[model samples]
Target: MSFQNTASFPGAGIPEQVSFDRKELSVILSLYGRMVAAGEWRDYGISSLRECAVFSVFRRTAEHPLYRIEKRPKLRNRQGQYSVVGIDGQILKRGHDLKTVLRVLERKLIRAVD
Candidate 1:
């Protein structure tokens, strides 16, 4: 019995996990910082999955996220890779540009101030 070694190849048995890049995180964090200062958001979470990456914003630590920012590379060509989902699982915005997609949340921040 002979067994072939697969150790030579990196990520041979590893599943790919999608995540936000530095630039992407920069933009997201900028908004998060503003929200935090405004007292609109208090907690956040990040998740990296095989198909997509998610950044969840929470009003409180124990409750469900108020919004979810998702990056699905597979949708890059079809409906754009970036999307913002509301608490009720509705897509608020979707586009190729992260900043543009995140503008939906910014609008809420504006409303909170007034």
Candidate 2:
């Protein structure tokens, strides 16, 4: 079996950090912009970790993240790769499609718009 570029450290078993590609980032940022314009979201941060890629949204910089969008490639076959987790660590949505999972957050945006 070949590890290739994905699993760089063959012996360490640390596996490289997961990350969002340009296209994925574009989609995430598009929603972020709309939410920001609606004043639903104030700040955001991205974290690429060994297990998953996280995009955390904060209403205020000092407070905890209000929501987190995570991508775990390992779950792509089982529970799906995309998930929306709330501030309380509850899974709001989980699916194979990233956009579909992110729809959960759009509900807040809808409320903010009207």
Candidate 3:
């Protein structure tokens, strides 16, 4: 007697995974560390969504995010690939250079002390 082979089913659509590169993470974490030391930030969260990836900073666990660092690969060809959104949902800065994009938040850190 011969054995029969099982049939294959339809393929499922897999969602694209979003992630931050080493250099990108380095730039983000550098700012985050400074904010933490300044006491302006206490907690942080990261999200990898379909269209973009976000790094959220919070002053408190239960409160809204104080800042959001976002990376949208689609925008790389246009305005930029990196963006910083304020708590009010406004785009504080956007540019191709991660360091330049993060300058907006750094300004806040400066005036926060002076």
Candidate 4:
């Protein structure tokens, strides 16, 4: 079988995978640290897809993710790129500002303390 170098051909036009930049990861990790300290979070996973990137938080490694923070650049103009989704598969928040969108999860930390 023959192989193709689509990845090597710059002009071939493939969608670039999305990922968390350093600044974005810093913000996410900051919240993760606080949540972990609060005993609300235990594990996390990250996915870099062609059209979107996701950061999933888990209460336990063996169970399903408790939350998923997604960045879909394609929706940046329509519904904003950053979003926080609950374990029930509901959108907790969506906004252009990553920090603002993450506040939804941060609020949980407060309730966990109360």
Cα displacement (Å) at residue 79, model 2: 1.1
The parts of candidate 4 lying over 4 Å away from their true place are 1-15, 111-114
lDDT rank, highest first? 1, 4, 2, 3
Q: Predict model 4's lDDT versus the native.
A: 0.92
Q: Estimate each model's TM-score.
A: 0.85, 0.84, 0.82, 0.85
How well is each residue in 1-114 modelled by candidate 4, as lDDT tens digits?
Answer: 998765666545666688989999999999999999999999999999988999999999999999999999889899899999989999999999999999988888765334
- C-alpha local distance difference test of each model: 0.94, 0.90, 0.89, 0.92
Which model, 3 or 4, shows the larger lDDT?
Answer: 4
Residue-level lDDT tens digits of model 3 in 1-114:
998867755543444756788899998999999989988899999999988999999999999998899999889999998999988999999999999999988876775334
Instruction: Say which candidate scores most in lDDT.
Output: 1
Clashing pairs in 2: none
Model 1 scores a C-alpha lDDT of: 0.94
Question: Distance from true position, residue 60, model 3, in Å?
Answer: 0.3
- Cα distance off (Å), candidate 2, residue 72: 0.5
User: What's the CA RMSD for each of the models?
Assistant: 4.7, 5.0, 5.2, 5.4
Q: Where's the lowest-lDDT run of ten residues in candidate 3?
A: 8-17
- Candidate 3: Cα lDDT at 9: 50
How big is the positional error of residue 52 in model 2, measured in Å on the Cα after superposition? 0.6
Tens-digit lDDT track of model 1 for 2-47? 9997567776766588899999999999999999998999999999
Candidate 3 Cα errors over 4 Å, as ranges:
1-15, 111-114
